[model samples]
Target: MSALYRQARPTTFDEMVGQEHVKEVLLSAIRTGRLAQAYLFSGPRGVGKTSSARLIAQAVNCTAQADKPCGVCAGCRLVREGNHPDVLEIDAASNNSVEDVRELRERILLAPLLGSRKVVILDEAHMMSKSAFNALLKTLEEPPEHVIFIFATTEPERMPPTILSRTQHFRFRRLSEGEIVQKLSRILQTMNREAEPAALQLVARMADGAMRDAESLLDRLLALEVPITLAQAEAALGLPPQEALWGLAEALEQGQIRQALADAQNLYAQGFAARTLAQGLLEAFRAGLYAKMGLGAGPRLESSEEKLVAAMTALDESLERLLKRSDALALELALLAAFQALHGSAASPQAAVPGKPSLPEFNPVRRQPPGAKHPLPEAPPQGTSTPTPTQGPGSRPQMAMDLTQAWRNVLGVLKINQRAFFREAAPHLEGQKLVLVFPEKASFHYQSALKNLEAIQTAVREVMGELEVSLVLQGEKKKVESRSATSLREGSRNGPTPLRGEASAPAAVAGLTSTGSVSASSPPEQSAQSAPPSSPIAEPRVAPLDEPPAIAAKTAESALSSPPLPGDEPPWPDDEIPEESTEAPSSRAQTLVDDPRFQKLLRTFGGRLRKLVQDTPKAPDAEGAAQGDEGSDE
Candidate 1:
């Protein structure tokens, strides 16, 4: 007539399933008669806390000669039947008030009515009010020798510290799955019914370490009056079949989002609740994770450990929402989101099918074919005067305009000062080498450009793949004169000027001045006088100064028709120089300032190149010239 859990409640310590430590302590106290006045039992529900309390009451008052509370004794029968006057079981949840505690205190002072001692069990003791706890604190601290108190609660932390400190606290733990299964097996044997081991294990898992819940589930299944099977257990619990749950898990593991969703929808159509499906899937994933980790036995899963963890986490987070709304669509959406998280949207079944055209992958960079030239304006024919839009006073007509445009683009990405310094140089590409030619008089710009040569080379590489860069100063007769004067002054201060093989001034300066016929080996006086007022370095500048209007027209024709000068060569052997003219500093400065790129830079910075000053040739001092002649004779 009663529930199976109540009919099969544990009445003795030996009959209890777990909590060995709690039992050992309590049993020793009872046998040796060293019991404390108060005891606190705290743990999760259904782990024999209340039963242990009842057994203590029966044992302390038993009339047996040995194993006090012998199940056959009259005192034990009286307590078991709830008829003993010396023993009381209080439900603290309902009678938790100051008045209830005062009444209990008043009754505690009286002697036992039927046994040698009085036992009081307060269940769910944490539910008592603050005032009630205060009222009972005094009695619990120093109670009569004949009175024993036991408090059981699922949440002992809620109780006041003052109350917890006055009693012996024993924590009860949840029974493992094996222990619960063993207990269920004995219960089924007592009921004279048969059940599959899997059915019992399922019942134990559903109970979640609670023996009362497991017994209640087994009771429900037994009412069918047939041998219990896995299917019957699942049906009785309103859970989907294990096979279907495993199928859904497999689909998700294989990245078959559509198939998994369809399987879930089918389960929903068969009257399975959303919460039930989610719970079942959570268990399946947990089992698979455990099996992969070698923690326990479970179904073989091909999914990686990370994916299993992700799937489990997804189901767990969505379980609360699923319970609140009970919507099947929410579960499906959670599955889809989880699949996408593990393997992006492109991992859908349709994309994995063979012979199907997949979407093109995205590539951020566009590469050109080998030997293909950039789209640029065609070079004008020989003997033509027409100039391309990119050509200016210092620009060469035969050089491709792409290099100039690329240089402008590179400048756009550099700092303002770098752009300003390098803007004076003309860009020319010969073969695979890039040349930046600075004006003869713009020595400051050329030196500044050289210091930042690494930055310039990097920018060049970014625009035009892998190309060598060279910085060269436009050679001139004035440069040669300055060098001769400098050498004479240095020879007078230090010793005679070193020969070509000896160390000299900076290599870059020597490389520039020696481009003319006056080599480093030439004596200062002779090189200064016989430097041939017109040297090969002056050829390009002479053409521009002599015939300005026909320069662009003759640029291509002269390169093809003209022969090399006697001492003509690249200023730096590593660099290639395009045919260029050394226009006056003022003219060259005007050409750069008027350019659209320079104009844009000026507008951006709100400034201008106010004056273009050319360095005037200082006349050589008489002493230095005399010293140079003496040094040449020596």
Candidate 2:
């Protein structure tokens, strides 16, 4: 019997799963006879680079009428058996040397022993030394008509530009978990192997979208005599099940601190690996979020993981938060930290999550008014704190004295509660109105900011007292070739905390670990104090950086619409995301979010982010008036 199982091996081009685009391009190239001298296949491991290379070798060597290997043909059979003279396979990893490449170059010059073309397939090509790549460049640069090279590597970035330039590069994408599950389930059905739904989904996820990974996992499932469920698989793989992770999150949310710690210890005691525990719980948190989104019968789930999956469907802002973190390393770290937190251990310096988490802070700030003139009076005299009913479109805003202070208050509230406006805030103060400026012309980027305008206005009114609040949003205008221009753009870090201001921000740059410093990289704060008295209808209300970002934005917006102060700094430039105050390179220090600044912003912004564009340009010289085409098409 063959060492490989029939179900585990992909038999045809059509049967091959995922990598659809890669397969399509190759098939077109082959059918059109547009094959090149060399090809480079690169992507993450388990993502089909090597498999695709082998398929290409077979496609070219096949002596049949179909686009697939005919199995019985001499070339096809030889290729399948790993003995095709024309289909030369090499492990470039161990054989990475100048001499090895030289020898291969000599072989490439010769004609095929059996098939019409000679295909030299090199796996892990990135492992080839620089000298080796240099040696092979000449031959690879100009190979004979009978020669073709298929190079595969998990890391394409490591490959030299000279070598890369000569090859037709095809990026093999990572397979999504859903696709992997479909492929795995199909393979099991064809093999007549029974699997619990939980078992199957677990296997697919474990594959991380690599077809080969799914195959290997399927093989393991079949190898077991008994039926597989999530529990059994978790035991076998030393990874926590979805329930374990969900339960941990629930525990954290319910304030069951001891329970969280106990569950974490139990997981480790149950033989789960640290890395696996960290990542698995993180993923389960995301999955449970999806489950929580829907109320009734949860979306179809693996019978075993159904309960776990149902908990994830949350159709709210939290879901938005989950969708936002697309980077691999960030996801990994988030999960890893959750594990550490569950373990009752202090967050590793490496984790960098500051001491003040978000959930607890959400409530206290929500209680404050949008535009209250006086301080939040903690216990305002019964109804006395009501906004002193304002007259419309008037320049005489009663709280004019507190405008800057009110803006500072509103900015802080907005930063924590709602981010949409906080995101593209180049707000200008126009009388009592707060006109928010957007970075782009599209409605999508401006959608959120537009939606909560009323809530924001109310928030502003609560803080600034009895003034008309008109939310004006100006998209990128085509004011071409202006004699000169002045503007303020906002910037933020990728972390949870939105920057507060110059006062709340960290040093310009600080080294990461031992490497080069991680700079704040945000647009510098503009000062409300600088706006001239000639500003529009009102007087200047407050100083800059003394208040939160929302308040700053309100004040800036008021100032802008109020009137140009000639050389004075504008009123409503969004403050940057707050930094964790640190003497060293740690993102773990207490952020301004833990300070009074954090509280004031949440109260001021009215608890809703009407708008936010993740990436926007920096207004570096807006204060300097040294404007060039900076951040656009955000």
Candidate 3:
């Protein structure tokens, strides 16, 4: 039995699948009797360029009364049988010597015996020697009236420009996956064999748009002589299961580095070609990307658009590094890198605040209010008692007026570098001195300020007009005992017991974790007398370092605090705002606010964006002024 492709070789223009554009032009030319003397067919191998060439030859010499290439006509049959005296098919790859062209030139003088016109088909014509092409150039440029030449090549660029300029070039394109599948279905029907639609689809993809190649593959499968299933197709083609590739893609998307690496190694062990596997992964990822963009349907993998883009990017990079040789380590490393690229975003330093992980753990750090100097207490220990201030007779009183306003002014005037040194100072007026109390945790910040004391004093004097400033680092060990006792009492009287290590310890004992300091030349006794008044606002309260049990575990439970799903109530019921507020505005709306293109538009016409009340109307005089401005610009 001959090969399947040989048996299926198209003899007529209508029998050729795909290349409709090429077929239409050739058929139209033949029907109009305006055929070009020389035709050039170029495209990827097995897309029917050569087959189409043969069909054209048959059509031009057909003896039928209707359409040119009636297969039953003697002229068509003679060409199909390769016994036509007037027509010649040359394999230019082997007969590319000058002697071959010289002989052909001598034979061209003879007239046709069986057909009205002579046709010569040169396959792989680009392989011909330069000398041979030169010899054929004159005959090709001005051939006899009865002669026609058809040159087909996979690489047209290799052909000489002088020769190319004389021929009518027709580009043949690869068939679409759908088109290939349809053709395969028809072929299977001819064989009296059954194939699942999925099996045929797989065969189409494996063909990679080469119609002849697809036929050759189907020929092998038909040899099995069994009802072909998708599994059988995969085995016959030596392709790894789609599930395995999808699983690898899932692992990469989920940031499962180890799993992705293992999958690569496993596929390599299963004997799949590295280049072929990489190519498959690339195609799958490309399809997923298209689906994510709403361009087309793809594999049903439930992943966000961000993840699909990331996976595609990873696969693209990995495919480039993929070597066709035995070592699979390069591909494995690429998989690891891809997973890291997707997963590393969560662990980025920018995602973290002082004492919290990134979302959906919205345990946002307690940010200070716009003008306040201290952080707010975090979920304050219930029922904690405040200590009373002690007054001293000898204590000199600073300006008795509120210092908060003055403190804020000083902070604004301070340079950015200097502000970092003093931002942690919790200040309050006491007698004649302004006491700046540093929490034990901020002892390092206090130390950092020692060198910049003069700068702080100058900034303060400028803002508050010569007030006495005293710096005090809260003593660590002594206060720990007192605060722990207060916390325990509060826990016993009310809410849940505070977790051990819930309170922050002094930096001195915590290994001096941070470096910031302050220095002031005031007697310790004066600082002692300058205790802050019993008010929560008297000092900035520091949040405890230890996290609650709910926060310690990394889980989606913490994300409940984030914006709820559609129709859900706001997670915090006590807050007056409704749980389900309107959805956040689209990104396009936000982008418009700062879009550079919008900036250009603003510059082109002098205009500023502003809000207008519904009830408000422009006054006649204001309208006149606006018109005048427009007139002036014109």
Candidate 4:
């Protein structure tokens, strides 16, 4: 095995391929004779923190050493062999207690046995307990001239601030992909090995910025014969091919549960580890996002052109972002559950609950709810089971639907347009009309859907049963008038006021009235003459900014002769109810709601309407007045 391939560990600082900045500082200290009593080295794994510490020990104790370390020297050889008496390498992870640190402090009091400096290398120093750190604080503040402490940790944040402040800290950075690739190539060339650059690149990528990892991976590859290919790289790394990943995605897109499950099963059968699958899925989602995020036209998915590349790109981006936010274990569990639900056996009486996916307690993970129901095309009402998709790429699913189902389909298309309002107002549907009683009429009248009757009806009638929807605007007419209000009011089967107005709410140019009880029996022309042209105009008062805009008050002061009760429709005078008129009591009521004084009138007359007829008095003139009017309202 040695001859076949041995890890060519760094024998000197120069041989340490990456982390040039770290090597320069350490070497400068050795050359300048300005070494610190304690040092901290922090970086990702396989970046040579421990190896550098070893090299520093040999450099400091060298009887006959070169710029970094002379492997030929006895001290250097001993240090490399891990048996140097003067140097101690401790795993802080294992001996992280106060007692352990106390023992080391006692050892530190003694002089160097075999070498000039007695160096203690504490690996994973971040794991040291608080008391252990406190126990060494005094010694660290004023250590022996010959004693040196090197603390190495992957996570610096975990270290105590006091301990960190005492030591000289050096940060280690990961080797970039290109750097790793170059180093791997040089290593392979130095060994007189033959390997494809692409294969080497693959190994470097798998290393993910760790030079040590890349080197070890290269050694693993070199164990086999030379001339490595992409297939060999994939197989050795246990990563799936890109095609398999795309297949998984395609199955998910189509909602082909069975095929998707079978594919997942095949992956497990073919030694497709769950973590590996998770990584592959992540990559696919990332690629999808990249392709979809482009606003301009792009290449379509070659495998499934039914979706424009743009559409797939969008889905990919969303899925990629979602996947990245979670853990690998979580992702794997989701994949397995999806596979099991699609391919695993359906409910046998003895099986676990049907429809719901069960993740193993051993993996003990939460699975995301299965994706939204995909709308598959319905067959032509007969023996056919497969219905083709309505070909258009979308982030959502589509159904092969006919015109008959279009209405319901359209409403489904809308789904819950406004959940808050629908949740509050849906239950109000009664008979053929749906009423929304708002606190202020302005909001109801200004509602967009109500203004655009055609669009609202089209959106609603598609999903809901055939019905007429009335958006009865109550309270006051909105200050801002538009098509939305018009749509709602136009469809109103019964308005609390007339839809058409003789004039705008505040336009009082025409009507004039006497202060005395204006006769309900007076004609419009005679009423117009009662007040002169010089009569002061009543300007429409606007509601406060904080309050919802108020509706235009109805012109009830001049129009209402009969009094109104709370929630009651005021009766028109006997001769006033026009024969064959289209006005509804509700329409008339709408006009009343529009009037600013209408509410006040209702309160005043309510007691009279609710009272029983206690006494009957006959006035001779009342006989003619009460002759034919159906209304008895006073």
Q: Measured by C-alpha RMSD in angstroms, how accurate is candidate 3?
A: 31.2
lDDT of 4 by residue, 396-442 (tens): 13221222233334444453753223222222344444344444534
Over 1-634, each residue of candidate 1 has an lDDT whose tens digit, in order, gives 9898887777677888889998888888878888888999999898888888888888987888434567668888888878889998999999999999999988889999878899999999999999899999888888898999999999989989998888999999998989999999998898788999999999999898989889899889989888999999999998899988887887888878889999999999999888888889888878877888899766667876766776677788888788678877787877775676456533545544543121111112345645347854454455755655534543443344545566777787678988888999988666577788898878799999999999898988776667789988886545777999996665433223224233223221222222232334566555444321222212111121222323223322332233333443323333432235499756665565454543333322211100100111211543442333233223
Per-residue lDDT of candidate 2, residues 276-302 (tens digit) = 555555465565445666532222333
Cα shift from native, residue 274, model 4 (Å): 4.7
Question: lDDT per residue, candidate 3, 1-634, as tens digits?
Answer: 7888888888787778888898888888888888889999999998987787777778767888435588888888888878888888999999999999999988877988877788889999999999999999999989999899999999999999998999999998888999888888888788788999888888888888998899999988887877999889889988887777767776666667777777878898888877667766666666766776788755655666665666667767777667544367666666666666566565434543342211111122456756456777776544675532422322223222235556777888888988887889888665446678887888888888877888888887776665678788777545877998896665333222212222211211111111111102334454333322222211211113332222212111222122223343322336543344255545444444354443343222111101111112332443443333233223
Clashes of each: 0, 69, 17, 22
Pairwise lDDT winner, candidates 3 and 4: 3
Better of 1 and 4 by TM-score: 1
As a TM-score, model 1 comes out at 0.54
Q: Relative to the true structure, how large is the alpha-carbon lDDT of every model?
A: 0.71, 0.57, 0.67, 0.60
Which predicted model would earn the best lDDT? 1
Model 4 has an lDDT value of 0.60
| Whole-model lDDT, model 1 | 0.71
Error of 4 at 329 (Å): 16
Model 1 RMSD vs true structure: 20.7
